[model samples]
Target: MPALTDKQKRFVAEYLVDLNATQAAIRAGYSAKTAEQQASRLLRNVQVRAAVEQGQQKTAAKLEVTKERIVEELAKIGFSNMLDYMRAGHDGDPYLDFSELTRDQAAALSEVTVEDFKDGRGEDARDVRRVKFKLHDKKGALVDLAKMLGFMVEKHEVTGKDGGPIQTETRTWREVLRQEKKG
Candidate 1:
């Protein structure tokens, strides 16, 4: 086996830090065809291996910081859980009426309801609101309401025919109830 020069070893270490062997080879002034061979030799060097390990540690720390930033940003927007954060991705709209949510939408929202929420262990002041309600099917069989509706409870302002505020709170889907009764 041929030993790598000091310069080659350093190149390998730097390339392995962020780029795969092929990319590192090209960056290190080697042809693309030679990149794999150069990377292989570099991996065999004990000194280069140590450098790669140290670089990996630093990279992992940086990724952790990025993850924390995302979590903080989500929290600022009243997303108490990752589920809420991800659900907001659907339709690229942050605000959604509860009735507009489908079964899949509800399931995604429900994932954020931790045991703490059920036990009332913390103050609930997040933008997302939770409501408890029962759902019945056409035969009057009690459906799994929470499972069907998810975690978010929506309240809408009632409006008159002329779009005047009626000062009443109403659910978003009166039609769904009618459909359920007929089914």
Candidate 2:
């Protein structure tokens, strides 16, 4: 393959920014009306594809974005239970001890609020303080992990007019998690 011209190299670099070929072409100085066509032509060029691949490899190496790290982070958020952050005291009231939070639990924290106030008169005054914390997006993380583990399957059932199920499907998220833990 022949070498890429300066603008073509720039287009390849921009393309990796978001994997949007038309936008990359526009950013690389192509006309708005013809950016899409230009991007298609550029993608068909073997040299341009090779340049994009090389740039992607370099970017991945520089950022250290590995699949293992991504899965580990997703698992941390997906498996985290809100109950893990709360403890029941002898009084039977659940209270959160921020100091007792683990690394992943802390990472899962999305919001924290502290309110301290005095209640009643001076003679019967008591300190009333509340600490509230919201964790990261649990459902989103769970869905992402399920997809990564090949568990987010769309099970369609062929039904008669009465809507009776004619087919069944199953996903093994639990089994995959168990295997990961054992291994």
Candidate 3:
């Protein structure tokens, strides 16, 4: 393969940041007026394409990211039942046992927060601790999983004003008037 120029290499690196070609071209010092065209032209080059692919592979390798792994993580979130984390404490009060989180549950966890509140006077004070768990959107994860597994398809139907089937080949008043005039 032919060696890429310094600007081309920079463009490859910038493109990976957000996968925006025009922005990458502009950042790579291409003329702003022609950045879009330059981006398209550069992207079409075989050498540039190979470089981008190589860069992506290297990055994915470094990050240990893979399609199967991503889907498996999403599946974990999609199938995770909150019941698994809920357990009764020694006092029989229902509470989440953080230690019981599975690999998928751990992956699905987005945020965890603990808050403490004190009530009553100094002579009789009560300390209340609240633990909050913010998990990933299971519905969204399920949707993504369905799409990845080819179980989901975008359903678009042409409907009339009242959701009935669209009546095609129906001419408008203008067409009727024009036909009358032609006749």
lDDT, each prediction: 0.53, 0.88, 0.90
Across residues 40-145, which tens digit of lDDT does each residue of candidate 2 receive? 9899999999999888889888999777788889888878898888889999999987777889888788899999999899789999998998888989998988
Error of 1 at 160 (Å): 77
Q: What TM-scores do the predictions have?
A: 0.31, 0.68, 0.70
Give the better candidate number (2 or 3) by TM-score. 3
Clash number for candidate 1: 0
Per-residue C-alpha lDDT of model 3 across residues 67-99, encoded as one tens digit per residue: 898899999889887777789878998998878
User: Which of 2 and 3 is ahead in lDDT?
Assistant: 3
Model 1: per-residue Cα lDDT over 1-183, one tens digit each: 556566676576667567676677667777676678767877777877677776776877867755445434333333223333333646775543355544533433423322222433467544445543222131211122322344445567778768985666565467756865787
Q: Highest TM-score, which number?
A: 3
CA lDDT, candidate 1, residue 168 = 61
Question: What's model 1's TM-score?
Answer: 0.31
Clashing pairs in 1: none
Clashing pairs in 2: none
Q: Give residue 95's error in model 1 in angstroms.
A: 9.3
Clash number for candidate 2: 0
